[model samples]
Target: MAQHEDMQEIKKRRDAVLSALVDGVPYHRFLGIGFDRRGDELTGVLNFEQKLIGNPFLPAIHGGVTAAFLEVTSIITLSWNYLWQDMEAGAIDLGALEAGTLPRLPKTIDFTVDYLRSGRPRDAYARAEVIRSGRRYASVRVEAWQDHRDKLFAQATGHFLMPPPVTEAKAGKPG
Candidate 1:
């Protein structure tokens, strides 16, 4: 039936988006960032590791590491949430990427982070909310927490430059 086929298609698309995220991005892998999806919500997790520790006295996760984690979480969430617009025909080209050729990454126009408390050495989790998404830019609000969602250690707002739309990518044209 058409409904069954639609479900299959949705599952395939979901896999593609997650594949491109965990495999395609280098920094994501380095950070041990993984996702836990509950319906439409995704919690990005940075698994605690000893190397990530910054302050020897308090033994906390590095501020920079936490910042990068939050940024990547926002980017991944946005990319997945807008896959139809972000990818080619809603299909992620893993083959083209294997050849070291791929679409562009959205550049950061602005990023502001607020460190509310020491990021204790433990698993870190982040969630991003897209405030506004436009053709040229997107604004995301992100928060990172350890232990509990309400107990936040850092929060950030980011504006990223979106890549050109599919209409701009033409045959025989370098994008």
Candidate 2:
């Protein structure tokens, strides 16, 4: 019974984290980005639509869309890492997350993308790896793939300014 309750608690935390990622940012919803979380790993999903096409000639996904996907993936992955720290310490407020008052996501310092090939007009998936994370900064690498994960359509490296942790006092809780 104790183990079952523990599993339920973990599931709740995971759901809250995903909600913060998908619903906290408006653009993420507008762009049709979805996430799949398996333990600590995440994959960003871009649901294809006709409106996302750049050139009807090549019928490729827009460069801007691809770039946005990579950037979003990196940012969310880094944010997840930060949130996990609080989760491990049992310091996260699930109510705040559910209320959409999540801690600020990291701000992008620089993002560089390499378009290996045109994104085909279909669903695209991306996975980000937080290469380095520190108190004040983080670095992430992302790869977007279409049909094959090994055959990437584009890849990116991003640096971000990590936000300071929010404390109970700052969050308007009695400290």
Candidate 3:
């Protein structure tokens, strides 16, 4: 059925995005971020390690690392969402995204991170949501958790400059 084919295509796109994200970004791999397909959304996980600890005394993960993880997760989520729009509009070649051409990708406009608790040395996970997406800009919210979603280690919200399929953003139309 057409619905099944569409779902398959979406899964393929997500896989491509995940590949390009985890493999393409060395830092992300260094952070040990893992991707999970939870029904529809992507979940990011970072297993705890000593090197990630900024305060060995507390054996806590670095605040900077947590911030970086949130930022990277948000960016990847936004990029993946944009992939569908770009492919649908035929605005850019799929290979551009697949090739890991991050040089031309969206840049952070503003980022605000809130450290809810000290990140202990353990496995860390993150969830990102695109709060809003315009043609040229997007706003995202991210949360980093160790054990459970309700117990968050950090939360971040930011805006990014989207590149492709942004023709109408500058003209003030919805993306």
Candidate 4:
């Protein structure tokens, strides 16, 4: 079925995007967050390790690190959603999109993070859902949880403005 092929394409794209985003971050570098794509949802896991430590007393993972994980995962999920749209519309080449080369980060018009619990110094998981996907904007909700625990450490909602296609910009460039 065509839908099966589309799912394969999406998985490939998600892997590429995840690798690109996790490359330069220090915490993500050490914590080793793993990206898994399931249809429209993305789930990332971070294992507790020395690098995530803030203080030995509480051994709490830094809040900033938690936020970063949530943000990046959410953005990538949003990007994947957009890619799916492109595929459905038959508007762009999937190969170019997979090369870390197409569409840029959409401007983040609004974001709100709510802390539900403290970041544990152990395993943590983040899952995101796309609330709305429009031509130029998307809304996503992300939740971070301590591994093997039902409590959430943090939850965030992000609104991003998808940028115009790179090809469109090139077409407008002065010759």
**Highest TM-score scorer:** 2
C-alpha lDDT of candidate 3 relative to the true structure: 0.79
- Candidate 3, residues 15-85, lDDT tens digits: the string is 66567766788888888877786555788888777889999898799989999889888987787677655
Best first by TM-score, ranked:
2, 1, 3, 4
- Candidate 3: worst-modelled 10 consecutive residues by lDDT: 166-175
lDDT of 2 by residue, 24-77 (tens): 889988889988888888899999999899989999999999999999989888
Q: Total clashing residue pairs per candidate? A: 0, 0, 0, 0
Report the C-alpha lDDT of model 1 over 7-88, residue by residue, as the tens digit.
7876666665566666677777777888886645788999988888889888888999989989988987877666544443
Reference-based lDDT, residue 65, model 2: 96
Model 4 lowest lDDT segment of ten:
18-27
lDDT of 3 at 168: 47
Error of 1 at 76 (Å): 1.0
Q: Which residue ranges in model 2 land beyond 4 Å of their true spot? A: 168-175
Clashing pairs in 1: none
Better of 3 and 4 by TM-score: 3
TM agreement with the true structure for every prediction: 0.83, 0.92, 0.79, 0.72
lDDT of 2 at 76: 85
Question: Which residues of candidate 1, in runs, are more than 4 Å off?
Answer: 1-9, 85-102, 171-175
| TM-score of model 2 vs. true structure | 0.92
Residue 20 error, candidate 1, Å: 1.1
Is candidate 3 or 4 superior in lDDT?
3
